[model samples]
Target: MADQPPIPFHRGHFLFGSTFSLLRDSLGLLRQLQQQYGDQRVVRIKVGRRMITVLLKPEETKYVLQENNRNYGRGRSYKILREFLGDGLLTTDGDYWRRQRRLAQPAFHRQKLALLADTMIDEAVSWTSQLQRLDKTQPVDMSAALMEATLRIVTKTLFGSGLGDQTTRLSQALNDLNHIISQTVLNPLRLPNWVPTPANKSYINASGLVTDLITGIIRERRQSTGKHDDLLDMLLRATDEETGEGMTDAQLLSELVTLFTAGHETTAASMSWTLYLMATHPDVQARARAEALRTLGTRTRFSADDLRAMPYLTQIVNESLRLYPPAWAMSRLSLGPDQLGAYHLNADEGVLISPYLLHHDPASWPNPDQFDPNRFAPDRSADRHSYAFLPFGGGPRLCIGNQFALMEMVALLGQLLVTFELQPITSEPMLPRPLITLRSKQPIRLYLRDWPV
Candidate 1:
């Protein structure tokens, strides 16, 4: 029942709180407390005018994200993201989020996913085929390679046929955007766009590039005589429930940016980490490869139904996500006074939810650091708190494209691992850089052996 402020002695003035260090080493600070303060309800970290409360337990995390979700709002990280992402669901709250969520929800429906499956398999084949062209002695920088594959998957899913290399252009633009954002997220004392810092200039340039690419696609679609069977068409034709009108050009651009960014970035990171882990662990790799090879031998294509049948493949993915979820941490703002377990939170206080910390909690996960896919076995998983594992988060604000990301990974990883052996050329363990997404701090190099390395 000890509901007090977080251990508040960082190297900062009392009134100013721990501003710089909070930005520079956020997760480091949180994980430091995770082991020593087991089951502690809330620990407060002061940031500027706000007392940021960090939640470590599943039950408390569940209450903020789900049961009392109404009393919380999207907080800091998202607010900073708004500068680049605009008013997409990730940044907006209240009625607009509901409307946009409803309008875009159908794009990721199970039926819609089936439509995208053949294309996904086809793209995977083409991508891996090119890798075969590379000399085996030449190690691949998987971080970049995965981003290219994932960006194409997202674009094809949304735009369908007849768009040539637009996905590549968009990918480069987003890559530049990611670098600019990394600096912004890491350095809390941001210079405004007018101040003309190098990062600010890069962001403006990247933002313009994204806007131009999306607007061009919209213009081309409008000029065409036929309706395409893809997300862009669906979005173009969607009508608001009350207004009976489609989205404005600005709204369309915002949603396009949101979906395009969200759909690919995290999935690519997850795939990269999963591949790195498998490459480093022979037994884990063999087991996953066995399931995939059995499921899809001598076949280049994987149907949507194939994903459902691969239990071990699914478990491997679940475990990789446990270790390196791309959306590693989430933030929320208190809408009003509230109590979570024994801790009392004030109105407008920022709350930090670190799934990266929760997934590693030894109290819930025995031998937490070890990689074991069997942790996701139905019986074992059922006994754990529902919120104990939140790679895609939970409740009403759960990632809308969770299924899309899962389906993409299952199809791509299951098929690719069967075709190629990912031999890690990077050191024994990879280091993570937590930013807009969880990414490898350095290029994760892996040799793409034809198999049985």
Candidate 2:
């Protein structure tokens, strides 16, 4: 460890290092650092005594996330996530995570997800109906609406459509908890979850509300004789193939919380960003809508196959994810000393990989900043590096709900475009807010006008 060569680093404040700039504008500082150290595979930034090493190229990213993935583990941020999420797939590592993932994996199978398609399209159509009734002159908060819609879709698909009024309650409680988690993770001085601070107390209340609602539903489902065939039912009946033991109620709670929170949050952000881009780019909007209309014709309901058929609409979603990936920046802690690209990484040092950076690399993606859906068109995408576009991340820990999120986004966007003409309320572009997921700093407001029937 003592004999290793020093890695190149970004210079920051004399005392605090990159802490101030990192907290103020993380993405901007990262981009700046990458440019300052051009062609360097790995660049380090010191935040006080801690050094964060960011992989700069697609090859390095592929190495860490895929080729040599076993040497990396979930970082400290995931430890903070476990405070609220418990030891679920997103938070756990090694054997435990593998076991839980195995138990829950069947629920996300294409056959199972196909059964949930109608529920997703139904919720999206219902949402569009709500938009249709609203005054055309008023600007709608598309961000909040998409969040609510995705929440409902996840809720119904997870626990079934019986959650009539609990949907809003769960949505509010989850939002509060997500906000607290994001703040806690980002704030270096944040108090422990056990602390009696107001923020901590508020977090506890929201967590309790979510727990009560989910547990009550679980208990009811357990006592019922009928089957709903939802994710909850699959989880309830799932057992370990090795031990033949099933998840305990407590284990179920953790997985449920993980699924509920992770399921909708990122997808909603992606949809919101897509809408923002569509509103700003009328040409893209027209083309997408035209494709949707031509594909669906007069039908409002869509099947998974129908969604798969709309390649251009899928491109728009892919490009949106490329621009504003929900899990924008991810971290992994090195398990041991290793060579990554040109740099040697020490055990326990933090390793950062940003899809945001990779997606915007001028070398990999020409006009990287521009919104070009055709970049994902099959012919153009053939030669792109495998890890260059990691919207759902890569390797074994890739998001379990990736396909489900795609189907929902494409279906919802298709339904929306065919029904309404989205008009941006303001010409100013919405800036990305780096929360748990990448979201708009301001509410993405749009005025919806009924399209010709």
Candidate 3:
């Protein structure tokens, strides 16, 4: 066991080690580590008493997440997720995760997703109209607005139109939950949930509100005889092929919470960031709006096919995802001794994969910090590694809703751009803050004027 060569370690304070830097600016620290230690070797660092080996290359990420995935499982943070989100696919692993994934997979298929296209576009158009009515003199908090809009779409698409009134309540509760979860994860000094802290009490109240609302919705659906043809309907009707079984009520609750939270949050972040980029890069925004105007000419409503026709718009979405992926970092704990590229990992050691770092690697992406959506064009991306730009992750655990997210982003962006000219209120770039998802540390304020007819 001791014969294997030791992994390289980053020098830090002897006592706290790299804990302060990690707590202060993990994103910056990760980028610094990648620069100090090139892609050829794995870099190890200690935070508090725990040790994590950072994977810098695409091959290493692919190995841990795909080829030899069985040797590595989700890390400890997932337990915090399970505590809040229940045993949904995002938290559970092994056979249970597989079963959940299979049952939920069918709901997100392109064919099934097509059924909800109108709902998505309609929501975006409706939200756009609402934004148009706002006083143009004041800057709108785009981050908040996008979250609200995506929440509306997710609720309608998930539970059919019946939950329209619940969106506001759900959105508020989810916002509180996100803040609580972020504090718990990032604050090393956070107290235990059982300690009766004010934050803990708030978390409990928010969790209860969400649980009750969802439970009541599910209850009403089970009692109703009519079919709604939404995700919930499909989930309720889903049956496991092997076991000939279905998800229990508790299982349904967990999955609904997961989809409702994950479904909207990530897409909202992507849209917010993309719009920020578009506001800052007028040429790119003009090009994208031109593409949208051409394809969606004089139409108040467009089909999924219309979204498929915008290649340049799709490129913009992909590049934004590369720069600011919602799931910026993934963690896994080795189940046993394993070798990742040239380094050997001990059992129970933590492995960290940062998509943010991979996307910014100058070796893979020349002048990586620039906002060039053309980098995603077919000719340029032809030879790129599959794992190098994983915004939704890679391998079997890839986000089930990736296609759905892309379609929604394209729909929302297309709808909004055709109607409004996005103007950034400030020149400062929005900083990324790692939370339940990668989010802007501050609200993205934008002033939108009607696009010239």
Candidate 4:
């Protein structure tokens, strides 16, 4: 057997017998697998008819995400996303992704984002207004509230108009769509739009609503001569610098959907976790609140300039992302054979890297599970490798909206900390659901007591 060709480990019977088992406790299972097999172990697990290898170690993750990125494409997991995103930056590969990234670059520039900061703060105020009316004695679903807030900000920033009446309906559709994509990973059947499984039906209907909303916005923008300079306006006016060609309506629609889905959902999850952490860690919360008050004074409003000046607030956001990265696991299919540490990865094989695992790894992080924002402090920095905390990912394909997401998060959190003292409702642990993004399986509930100056 030692001289014979090595067989990839097949724990097929165990996996097949427990379809829901892996799904139910995925984070726990991945941790156990990494501990037992030491990072590079190859195990075959079925996703419909196909088998996929789940890579756990940081070294292997770096190679797949950065070193050998060319050897991999975005892979099959993003197909459903493409139905909504339509060859947008996240789903496309090679030249297509590069082109979209270039075109979309200008809108996300720091200067442009600085201008959008006013809009973001306005939306933040609108969000907190709803919470102001909530009774301090009542437990509120911070996750849902954060989702609504971030969605409003992203939509307004992207479209320059309130989503208005469509807000609740669109929010529900997005929630359903996210659920379907995550669940379908284990049951990968490529059914047509006509097929009627509850999941598939939800996906089709939700995607159609999103697509229609985007199409209407695009049509209105095309007809108007006004220059709003918002993201949608910028996208509408963008001509390929080289070819002088604008994105097709379909392409534009896809990107709008992608932005709405990727841009909002992840930010919402990150803020929810941040608030939960703040609630559980009162000292940290007090420090953050003090910092916000010191920076903003008695002002009810904060601007981008004020947000930039708040370093401690930035640390809280960074630490929250470290603990619960929104885009938790990333996968790529190898384009050519390559050497990854001690193992030989074959061309066409799928490679997976989970930030959820790497962020909590004890080897890289001291007191790995502790909620310590000071780890990000300049003087006592954790002194880890660059890829160790890739909540936004890395390389050329690093998330384009990283700056936008961070600024939005810091601005909102800073504002909230000043207005309310958050306290956790349940002592139950906040379990993570590894879907399209890392999200809390249960809504993060918090008591929002008004802060007295």
Best of the candidates, TM-score? 3
Number of the top-ranking candidate, with lDDT as the measure? 3
RMSD in Å for all candidates = 2.5, 1.6, 1.4, 2.5
Model 1, 1-453: lDDT tens per residue? 264643433335556566666676766766776755665656776676666777888998999999999898998778778888888878888888888887877777889778888777777888888888988999998888888888878888887753466666667778788777866765656777888877777788888888888888888888888977788888888887777867877778888888888777888889988888888887888888888878776776776788888998899899999988888888899999887776667788888898898888887899988989899999898889999999998878898888888888888888778778888885668888887788888877899998645
What is the alpha-carbon lDDT for the whole of candidate 3?
A: 0.88
Q: What tens digits encode model 4's per-residue C-alpha lDDT throughout 1-453?
A: 234333144353554632444567767766765665554444444544555666655666677777777887887777766766788988999988878887888888899899899999988887888899988889999999988998899888999988889999999998888888777764544566678877777888988898998899999889998889589988887878988888889889878888988878989999999999999999999999989989888687897898799898899999999888888777677788776655565677766667777787776777778889998888766567777788988878888899999999998998898889998887888988877778888889999998765
Clashes of each: 1, 0, 0, 1
lDDT of 3 by residue, 355-434 (tens): 99999988889999999999999999999998889998988999888898999999999998888899999887789998
Lowest lDDT 10-residue stretch of candidate 1: 3-12
Q: Considering only N, C-alpha and C atoms within 3 Å, which residue pairs clash in candidate 4? A: 71-335
**Evaluation by lDDT, superior candidate among 2 and 4:** 2
Supply the TM-score for candidate 3: 0.97
Candidate 1 clash pair list: 6-44
- lDDT-wise, the better of 2 and 3 is 3
Per-prediction TM-score? 0.93, 0.96, 0.97, 0.93
What is the lDDT, from 0 to 100, of the residue 69 in candidate 1? 95
**Residue pairs that clash (backbone atoms under 3 angstroms), model 2:** none
